[model samples]
Target: MSTLNLLRCAPHALKKQPVWVAPSRNIALSSFLRDAPAATASTKVLPGHEYYPGKEEYGTVIGNREIVGHGEIPYYSDSFMVPCPAIRFKEVDEELGKLREKEKGDWKLLTLEEKKTLYRASFNSTLEEVRAPSGDWKRCLGDNAILIGIMFFGLSVIGLSDPEFEPITVTNEWVDAQTEYLIKRRVQPVDGISSWYDYENNKFKPTWSIFTTKETSQSVKTLSERGV
Candidate 1:
């Protein structure tokens, strides 16, 4: 017979039997303690003081002093205090002096290209090597293969179907284009601000000016004087 027919034949077997009840015992003290009302906020007792219910307007007292709500007492101690080192400032100054001397020595060793690279790195230059890729494609493939193998093994153990994994493919031309784009972005001058070279300061200061008619006329006059 089918599962449904078997269940219908034993319908009384599925019905719940009557539960047994124990005899009740007298618990006058327990009932009184359980049903007793808790102390309200106004009638609450503070440490070292007892609150008098119904006389809450006057408040509690202890040893001639009227006890108000718990008062905060500021505490201070030097139990775990640490003593300052005698040569703290002197040691710090000596270390800073040594660092400055070392920096001066290192600055002399760095080439112009290395200095420029350092400056570019301080900015948004993500590439460690501008001309070539930093990581090996073989290593990346190996890592991906291991990850996929683990995933497939886990799915198989759990009785799941294996998913198709596609490999990432890139052309030499695409990589070169990306490298060129990065180089261009790294060396590109700030927009809306030209003539940044400050002859007086011997440094470039990125600045911009509004092209008003008055300023334009003044610039033209200056350019005419310079014979530009």
Candidate 2:
């Protein structure tokens, strides 16, 4: 199934697992954590004011923009320019240092199941459109909001204080690492869930890394190859 559906269903399947709320082992972050925004068919990106008129015929920026025409939508360019790696690395390093300090003493307090449930529920509620009413366990969580909330919760339980947006840097990297690690470790595991290690003060913090079953991964691969 799709990543969003898995997250929506996870809480019910794994109730009160401490790992869901607060994981104790290092896990990898999966695409499910990042797919919400992209998965919503209702979502759309309006063209930015910085349109490239010169490259209109180049099939680059054109794919990037979405224009409505003749009762249809057209995609322009796909190439998105990010900052230079050197600058990115420096910024990431600075952020990581602060996160290390902010997350100090936070480690493996909650079980992996609890962390997962909380993470999944919070993520759905915060990020995606909430199908269930407020206070429902199955609402979607926002990527940045939920990450910060969970990170803050984890850190606060251990007597640490977060400033703001600190978790994004840490969570994004952790998620990427987790996804890569899982894809490497398991041959086509499930698609939506993710795993990762929580760290603080240069030490690997105890946290549960969520993972998809190998069987599910194989099924996903089979379906994907068949374009199902």
Q: Indicate which candidate wins on TM-score.
A: 1
Which 10 consecutive positions of candidate 2 have the poorest summed lDDT?
82-91
**Candidate 1 residue lDDT tens string, 29-114:** 66645544421222434421333222243322221222212222211111112111111111124544444344345466756764
Runs with alpha carbons beyond 4 Å of true place in candidate 1:
1-128, 136-139, 155-228
lDDT by residue (1-228, candidate 2, tens digit) is 655446343322332221111121233466545554444443332322122223345335334322221111223211112110100111124534444343333535545664544443223232233433456443444566788899988877666453453555345445545544554464342333322222223221123223435544444344334333
Model 1: residue 29 alpha-carbon error in angstroms: 96
TM-score of each: 0.16, 0.14
